[model samples]
Target: MSLETIDLSVTIGDKQILNNMTIKLERGEVLILMGPNGSGKTTLAFALLGHPKYQINKGKIILDNNDITDYPTYQRALMGLGLAFQNPVEIPGLRLSMLLNAIQMKKSGSSFDISSIDPKLIIWARNKTRELGLQPSFLEREVNVGFSGGEKKRSEMLQILTMDPKYIILDEPDSGLDVDGIKLIGETIDSLRSAGKGILIITHHAEITKFVSPDKVMIMSKGKIVDEGGIELIKKIEEYGYKDYEGVQ
Candidate 1:
């Protein structure tokens, strides 16, 4: 599977968030997007997920060889596109298990028979929770309601792992996570990649890059990808901050 953006651009009100942004993500590969705050990392993620706020002024988004630039958000999701927001909204009154079951139904197009649901799903959720150092009871609680930063990250991972999307875009998954939380997110993402899913992560902390082992890195500045390279760039960014690159390549 693959995702490609061809000269994609977006604007809100009088500000242009993304300008001629083009990127490609292939199967079993992880791409890390790095930039300063307000460099359009989240905007790009939202655009890919077909958010209604960010209007696509020009360009096309092709996913798995299908041109879905015009598809609605739900249509894109049905086509196997998934997003983990930088600030995920809390969906009250919805149990984590129930949400996962709903995703399972959506993916398999199966009847809404909870009895027919695979028992292994529970095991899978349990294992992921343990791996993320979360409590098993989290799966029984309302989705993200009163959850801590780490717990919310775990919830996002659980949803993605269950959905098993072909192309997964994580918008700043490391935003509010600690050391352990970052490691857990990395492990979950690696697990997904091993299953043949392409991953795109938007992050600012180069420290988190150590966990994910990204195949490619893109640096966004002033509404566009100005620099791109291999993992070595991540090391360079960490050792010498991004300011060194300002006004000089």
Candidate 2:
């Protein structure tokens, strides 16, 4: 399975946030998007999930060869598309397990059973939480209600594992993480890659590439992908930063 964006562009009023951006992630491949702040990385992510604020002025978002640019967020979720937000909102009165059970039912189309839930999922989540230095109790709390930055990212990662979608788009998974937190996030991506999941990771930090060894790297600036290359580009960015590369004003 694959997700491809063809000549994608998004505009809000007179501001064009993304300009003819094209990107593709095949099954089991991880692609990293690197750019400075306001470079439209998040804009592209939100557009893929069909956010109402960012208007899809022109372009098509295709998942597994089916157009999904006009599909609602929930519909897209049901179609094997998952998004891990940069800043997840706090939903009061919602337990983490309850949310997971709902998503589990949606994906597997089976009756919710905490006892019969997939062992692999529970094991992975347990291991990930331990690896991230989080308490097991963290998983039982409300979603992002009072989570720290690191906790929130780990929570999002757990959901991704549970959903096990065909395509996963993560926006800035490394932003507020410390060394261990970042490592856990990288390990999670590596696990997903090994399982043949298509991943699109939006991040500015080059350290994340060390963990997942991205197949492709797309550099965005002013809402356009100005450069695309391999892991070597990640090294160059580490040495010289985005200013040394082309297309940034």
Provide backbone clash counts, one per model. 0, 0
lDDT of 1 by residue, 1-249 (tens): 689999999987667789999999998999999877887889999899888888899899999889988889978998999998788789999888888988888788886765555678888888877877888899889999999876787788778878788999998888788898888788778878888889999987876766778989998877888888988877777888677556632
- Give the local distance difference test score of model 1: 0.85
Candidate 2: tens digits of C-alpha lDDT, residues 128-247: 667767887776789999999988998988788788888899999998999888888998899888989999999888888768889888888888888899988788888898886554
Question: TM-scores for all candidates?
Answer: 0.92, 0.90
The parts of candidate 1 lying over 4 Å away from their true place are 111-119, 244-249
Candidate number of the best TM-score = 1
Candidate 2 lDDT score at position 198: 92
For model 2 the TM-score comes to: 0.90
